[model samples]
Target: MSLEVLLDTNTCIFILNHRPPQVAERFAEHPIGSIGVSSITAAELSFGMHKSGSEKNLERLKHFLTPLAVLPFDDEAARVYGRVRAELQARGTPIGPLDTLIGAHALALGATLVTNNTREFKRISGLALEDWL
Candidate 1:
């Protein structure tokens, strides 16, 4: 499965908020259909929505996710995640589980990961990354 990009939760949040023109502009450069997100990101956004307890934010998140492809943590992604997690653990540099999952999803789909947290995502071997923020 070919994908142009996989947006991280932070990038999606930035797009939803429309703050920091630079970040927003970077997101805008890609066509909506070409942009993708991991199911993990969807869950993360949903969690934020639930925590906020704001119907308005929930609506905004729904609208934002409508056009983008939400990739699942399928078998391939799971395998990638296991390898990545093991490698990081072996190196004594472990990132968040969600971040590792997101990286695995991107790797499985051959999509460049757009994130602001390059410092963490960079630890995943063979995962292409870009800092849109």
Candidate 2:
């Protein structure tokens, strides 16, 4: 599947919880295989699962991930990360480390990042964004 949209952690959580409904509605508007999450996003979700220690939530996460591709943070993404981090640091508007990685992943893959945290993500120049919420 050629992923066109990379779901951020918060967007995934909103979908999982079915809040506001529009996020899931917009998600459904897209074709399958065109949407996915970065491995960094999966890690963030995993952290939440571990912290909550809820088997039900874990199972839900597993089920949520079953159909979507979890794109890995590869060498290309690392290269993008370096550039992104440097640019953000230079601008004196550095976001969180994980967010930088996530943005870099989306930038590397040329996928539009679907996120609720646009204020933070918008700091990365040339990174496409869509706030489903």
Candidate 3:
């Protein structure tokens, strides 16, 4: 509960009802702390929930993200995104677009990314990430 975090999209879904997620406790850290989400994740979650047609699940998601500090997908984030993407690619390690963008947002907020995909994220230099698992 000591570290404030920005959740990766997968982890955010767990916030709704996945009790066994190792990082669920991290969300409690931010009852007052801002839980940052990438715009891509917001969209992905909305799409999944929409397709699932679970009003209860959708409500839970809204409540989960409606509060807390948000890092909007903006021009500044785009600049960082390009820089990070190029840097990673130059190193011959390519990550998914969503992950690259999420890492950028996490860096923008100076918060550690809470994710289980540590191996992929660790490749980016200077980008701080944590394994919720």
Which ten residues in a row are the worst by lDDT in model 3? 26-35
**24-114 in candidate 3: lDDT tens per residue?**
7767656665467777778788898899998987887788778755557788778888899999999899898889988887776667888
Q: What's the ranking of the predictions by lDDT, best on top?
A: 2, 1, 3
- List the candidates' TM-scores in order: 0.95, 0.98, 0.85
TM-score of 1: 0.95
Cα misplacement distance, residue 79 of candidate 1 (Å): 0.6
Better of 1 and 2 by TM-score: 2
Best by lDDT: 2
Taken over the whole model, the C-alpha lDDT of each candidate is 0.90, 0.96, 0.76
User: Pairing residues by index, what is the TM-score of model 3?
Assistant: 0.85
Query: Model 1, 20-91: lDDT tens per residue?
Result: 778889877787678899999999999999899999999999998998898888999999888999999999
Q: What 10-residue stretch in candidate 1 is worst by lDDT?
A: 26-35
User: Which lDDT tens digits does candidate 2 get at residues 13-119?
Assistant: 99999987999899888888999999999999999998998999999999999899999999999999999999999999999999999999999999999999999
RMSD of each: 1.3, 0.8, 2.5
Cα lDDT for residue 71, candidate 3? 59
